[model samples]
Target: MYNLAKYQKLKNKINRIERAELGFFPTQIYKLENLSARYGVNIYLKRDDLSGFSTFGGNKIRKLEFLFGEILEQGAQNIFTYGATQSNHALQTAIACRRYNLNPILYLVDVIGEGIKDPKANILLDKVLGAEIKIIEFKENEDEFEAMYRAKAESKNYAQEISESEDDYYLIPPGGASPLGTLGFVNAYLEMKAQEFKEDLNFKNVFHATGTGGTLGGLTAANKFINDDIQVHGINVSHKDDSYLKEVAELSTAALNLLGIDFKLSDRDIIVDNNYVGAGYEIPSTRANRAVKIFAEDEGIFLDPVYTGKAAAGMIDYLEKGKIEKGSDLLFWHTGGTNALFAEKKILGNLLDNHI
Candidate 1:
């Protein structure tokens, strides 16, 4: 479905860009036996979950490679960023900082207002990583957009202020969704394609959870470059409107532009299905919880409630609804947030219920 020659060409093209070796590359791609039998489709998994630097390896580690390379190139000693209290990106950033002995300052917004003082999951990891964390809890009846904007504005203001005074600080955008960060996934796309080629697998669909848009942007851009028959699917794990779609499309172009690839990405290239985001952000749904359990039970693989599990739910629904034909080749990109399985109960959403 993709060219092996273009894979080498992409490598030669992106090798010019500086990047830190933060995690082991070429994450495993393998088929799921039980799930494939159940779904009546060839369901394979790209185990980016096993991406190692720490045991908490995730898709964020890929973004960090390029991001930290840029940071080290600039000789940055301190870094600042924003995310939710339990963000996988924030925790991964902290881990990367520890490796470089760079100080990490995380200004986190409390989307769920679950009293994060007793940290769990990624928040606990941040503390272990010695990240200076400032949690922002929203006021009663406050608008979510207002709260998010205010938190980000304040975080950047503080970062800029500190940078002006004592030392320069590198500020990464939330979820590391910057154009440079998106390049990590562009590289990831090439890597996965190479694996598929080596295994002689032809995938018709590639599905993953989409948040912050960087990963999706990179994938869309690379898919355009390869012109493969594969359908890149982004199952929205959170709220996203047409504006978000357009923004991601622009980011796709920007990432391709960064790679010196002259390609224009349209709205058609970015296929986002927002149907799986039940309730709201960080709020788990029944389908997602079931999906998480199903993966764990059937394939002995873990999927978190927030991201990959929701995406799994979408793929499951598609299979059930005949959106994916029987015997079709499908690939699920496990972006890795299994830590959230041990997170707060509110987010877990009875994932442990109906147990033996």
Candidate 2:
């Protein structure tokens, strides 16, 4: 129920932003003929994985586009954000901050070991991007981590330490899921929707991993603006609880409001299935590994076990179970986290052992 005139106007603004060349290009969308034929459904991949720029480009970069734009518009000199030890969002935030010549300070929670030997591959990129890292123990209260980081960013002494003035912007939780930030993914959806007509195909369901929820939320809200029939399914790769669901809904509502789209979305619109995550966020599940191998073997596509693999597994499960009707076009979004594959070498040791 989004206003078409306002949606078109928002799409125009997004197109202007795209002309700036802030991130990579259209990141291909090719049909997965084998998988489609096997499953008796039309399947395509929106390869955000190919979003170029130091391997940091992915769905998160789309979100960072608007976030960094706001930071620059505010005349901020430094950027602050927090995440786990190896956060792709944090790494990409550092990259965008560098492009804008703004200093980035990353607060990592429960991080172990410095400089290499970290189980997360983004650690190396974090250092390479020259983002100042602070480790925090979050066992007691998670709010302390945010309070301490925000205080540090606001401190005159800390501002001098990063060689910045008191006027700087700090990004709140999970790559700025605010309405302003979600504009990036909303534009991305517009891009895909344009491609839909050119490809002569109609997509029914769009699936992606819901981690911090920004990508899925923005995409879902934008979908309502573009095509109401397009349903976005967010496969939760993190803990599936009420809090996470609420976060997704809130972000989606913000996104809708940002574009001046008056759309009423219920809980049913936000579909999050959390049956796949085996352990924690970075841990790999057995089903995800199998999905990775199957995709590699069948489509010659490599997927990271943490995000894309689990998402693909959920998509496949939905396909096999009749949830996704036959001939209903399915688009699986590849949010790149492939670097996490090499970070956890022990888990992949058996695959290499065969050749060794």
**Number of the top candidate by lDDT?**
1
- The lDDT for every candidate, in the order shown, is 0.87, 0.72
Error of 1 at 90 (Å): 0.2
**Candidate 1 regions with alpha-carbon error over 4 angstroms:** 1-7, 140-145, 164-167
Candidate 1, residue 260: CA error in Å? 2.0
Per-residue lDDT of model 2, residues 242-349, tens digit only: 667676777787776765557655555677888887675656677777778768877998888778888988988888888988987889999887876766553343
Inter-residue clash pairs, candidate 2: none
lDDT of 2: 0.72
- How accurate locally is residue 116 in candidate 1, as Cα lDDT from 0 to 100? 71
Error of 2 at 347 (Å): 6.7
Q: Tell how far residue 93 is off in model 1, in angstroms.
A: 0.2
> TM-score of every model?
0.95, 0.85
Please give the RMSD to the true structure for each candidate, in Å.
Answer: 1.9, 3.8
